[model samples]
Target: MIKTSGLSYAALAQAVNRLGYLAGKTLNYSKSAVSRWIAGEQPRNPVPELLLEVFRKKLGREFTYRDLGFDIAEADIEIRSLWYSDLSTTLDVAPLMWSHDVFRRDLLKSSAVAVGAMTAPARNFLPFEPDRCRSRTGSIPVSLGDVKMIREVAHQYWRWDSKYGGGRFREQLVYFLHSHVAPLLGGRYGEKVGCGLFSAAGEATMFAGWMAYDMASLGLAQRYYTQALRMAQAAGDRQLGGEILTCMAYVANSAGAPDDAIQLCEYALDITKGRVPPRVQSYIYSVLSRCLASAPSSPRNRPAALTALNAAERHFARPLDGSENAWVAGIDFRGLQTQAAHVLSELGMTGRAHEAISVALDGRDESHRRAVAFCKLYLGMVHVKEDDAEAAVAAGDEVLNLLPGLETARVQQGLARLQREINSLGDTDPIRTFNERARTLGDRS
Candidate 1:
């Protein structure tokens, strides 16, 4: 297994020791010790567990003692409970997941992304019915002010994620959710306060999911999204529920499940029809546009994508009467353009795609560095498709400049795609310079 993973014995030993230190134990395991373990000599307590984690991280999947040919009893690992029958059950299960996310993040990060797990939440939430009473009778008392604080903090986290990228503040947000907000969920609160608290908690949880998605931890993101949907259902916030489903759809599309993504977007649009504000409707339609565009290209797909995009634009032009949910309030016209750019690009409308991407880039400020980087990447790819090497190189250069400050895997992946596009443009001086600079920056990263 170690040979198959391409890890040297010394590297494996170092990884084990580092994991041990992180778990608050200090031990020196030499390469020879690793060799002995490989030769069928069992290591004592905690070593086996650490080895499993090391393999899990390396392989991007869960591992067991049996899989490693270790002659030991397989430890019963706790599978995260995602679905719940009632509000109380959800409250109990969600904190456990958050706690694991905070303390056992390695396991969560390497967990497989289960596309099927998404169905239950959407199935339960689309009915638009509120859960049973959310009022709790724990020792601590929760107030509307507390709920307000959670919402504010969640908004702040969103700003940080947009600016610094998810790798920077994801752990802090999960810790905040697990340590501060989990207790509040179990505290004493009236019906009104309970609804507000659940809504606030749902927003925070969804943000956590967004951060996970940003960091390329798709499995962890899915779990957080599922729980957020559950909380939204309990809060009876159909708008928020729809928004969460849209997020799930985005992640689903990114994970190569366009069918699931389209279904989720359809659910969001169906459930929130006539209930949400224009901006919220625009957000849903925009996501639907992207999902439809991602499907196998066909005569109907392009028209369907354009229709969704048009619906998004029409709804976005309507005047805001101050009733928009905070969750969808940030989906401004520029945000809609970003999604439009993607749909157009997928539909092979390079000229329109370039125009839409430029609009998105023009509207964003410095605080949205990650978003700007993504827009630039899209612009570069569109330039590539247009056979304009100079323009593409220019946009790629801008993305390169932004790469050093950002810590997002999505941006890295985007840069890789940009590199591939530039590589396709022959061996020109500008292309050579761009690739060299990209290589240097990537090495530094």
Candidate 2:
């Protein structure tokens, strides 16, 4: 019997895809080919050599034929041993169990210990307590290693996609979260590990929701967010729960449900009252401000926005302890300022909006290409409003330069809005010509 690495199918698939893509193949071999190899049909002649070459290039390592061996008979036995033999349950769960190893190479190695062939559900698959695990675990109970790895991957995707355009990766992440991780939530673990798993799953689910929102799939995003909220409740992580509620409010506000947004934000604020870091509290308020801005004009809306802005200001005025969640670390006061600028702009408070934009721009890190694109768009919009076509055009051009790097949908939407504004000024103006150029660049790219 050939003793191979015992890598899960997904890892090998990822490796193959990476190799094929690097080699510039128009259409690489199907996954079935690898499936066949794993099924114990020995690669004869040049194909075996080709496999070695592909793996070496893909993984940056050398391998002997023996290194990739597996017994044909054992393939089914090994797979069934790793997961339950029940096809129905395995269909629902194998992906999620295997996904654990996807994030951590060591976990995959450990998984090769092979689940017991007792014909019963694995030890990890606990009975689903509908009442207890109703929503996201309130407090995560899993090991620190799992928590850290999930966070690292989530943050990496968040930052990278925000800077580079979600494109196919956005879809890939959503699929993996839904297909490869959801089943683990159904499996058993100790209370400690269970809570931790729920927390990590909840966070990953929320991130999937964010990507959905970026793709303009509001309905799907809502579902993912709801699932995330449930996972948070299961983890018993109130802080994370509150944060996710605030995120849900953002989705609501974006979809024109300001009233819904306001209610959700208030609920989150109440839930986290006094327990959360000031940074989180500030974030909640910033989101609330968006709700207030979008709400129908009334004394209540004005006062609400003002109150939220004031509270955010007070929070930012204080020095944050280093213990805050890393996600909320750099959330400076400019976020509040940006919110103010947006609201003022909507209210036709042009001077105030411009002033706020200036302050926000000053505070923004231009190194973050997305932030620069946003600032430029906002500034351009302000100029367009003021009939400063030349200035608007200049700002729009800058937005175009950064557009190649910006992956956020909001930036693209902002650019479209600016283009409309420039277009309203007629086709012959220099501003119109500049807008046309920017539009072409985006369209062509």
Candidate 3:
């Protein structure tokens, strides 16, 4: 297994220790401990659990004690696939996914391919028939206070992800969800409590998904999002359900499936039934417009894009009534304009795109390095579109400066894209210099 991951035992031990630290454990793991395990002694208590995560993340699948040469009993979950019709099965699986994901970092090694993963999950999202409840009641009596705690924790994590990149906080967030929240599922609760529990857990799952998305692990994000969708449906949280679908739409858009993106957004709108707050509605419309504009110009859904964009603008123009869903707390004017800028640029509205993006860029929080990088890249693209070589070079340079400490694949890809655009402006000194640096953006070492 070490050979497969191309890691020495020392390196693997180090990885395990780092992940454990993120889980708030204070332990020093020596290479000899791993050697002792190889000599037929299983790691004591939490070490084995941590080791399992280390290897599971090293390889993108579950592992056993035997697989890693540790003499320990195997703990497995009966539920695995998201295709299961029973929401209870999904609830059972959420913790399983969270356990693996908490310390699992291998998924970030590549951009997960998005093909048909969401189809099964989204089908389940469409106003489905409720299944017989199968929650196994535990000793702890669930309460609204517990639900509120989960909601608060999930909201706090969202703010963290918005400020720091997901790569910075996903491990800690997943650790809380898996270690703290998952155990609650086994404790006894009535249907009402179950709904609240699932709803809160679903938000945690969505946060996990969003973090993966921020890291550019589209495929892993899909798995988490799929579970989130099922959990929300079981809880009958319609607003959250729509938010999950919209998240899927964002993934689809990034994965080069613009038409699929548009379809998913429409499905979300259908389920929302105008029940979402006006701010949330505007967010939904803004994303839909971005998708429509992303399609190839020949068959681009411009008419639909225009309608969606207009709706977004109209809704955004309304004052905040403090009635918006908590899940969409950051979906304000700047976020709307970010999508609008992209749509307008795609529609050949260069001047308006430039103005919109400039404002979006100016309004971005410096703590949100990932988003700041994206705005800079898009701003560079707008300059390229307007045939301003000097301006494009300047925007590209600033964005390049921001990329050194960021570890996100989508951001790197955007930089590569900006480089390509720069290349088309002829091989001048600024273009050539920017192009070379951009090529190194994907250098992992």
Best by TM-score, which number?
1
Winner on TM-score (1 vs 3): 1
Report the C-alpha lDDT of model 2 over 1-445, residue by residue, as the tens digit.
Answer: 1124454555555555543333222234455766788787774333453455445545656555566773222222112222222222332333443343234424323222111111112111222221253223324333556656776777777666556655436655655555545544554456666667667776776776676566555544554555566566666666677777787776677766677778778877877778778888888887787689778556689777867877877776767877566666756666567777776665556788788888877845534566657767878878878887778888888888886655667778888888889777666668667867876877776
Report the number of the highest-lDDT candidate.
Answer: 1
Report the alpha-carbon TM-score of model 1 versus the true structure. Answer: 0.81
lDDT of each: 0.83, 0.60, 0.73
Candidate achieving higher TM-score, 1 or 2? 1
Which regions of candidate 3 are displaced past 4 Å?
1-81, 103-114, 128-136, 297-300, 436-445
RMSD values for the candidates in order, in angstroms, are: 10.7, 15.2, 11.3
TM-score of each model, in listed order: 0.81, 0.65, 0.77
Error of 1 at 252 (Å): 1.0
Quote the positional error of residue 444 for candidate 2 in Å.
2.3
State which candidate, 2 or 3, has the greater lDDT: 3
Q: On residues 358-386, what C-alpha lDDT tens digit does candidate 3 reach at each position?
A: 77777576656766677777788888888
User: lDDT: which is higher, 1 or 2?
Assistant: 1
Which window of 10 residues has the lowest lDDT sum in candidate 2? 113-122
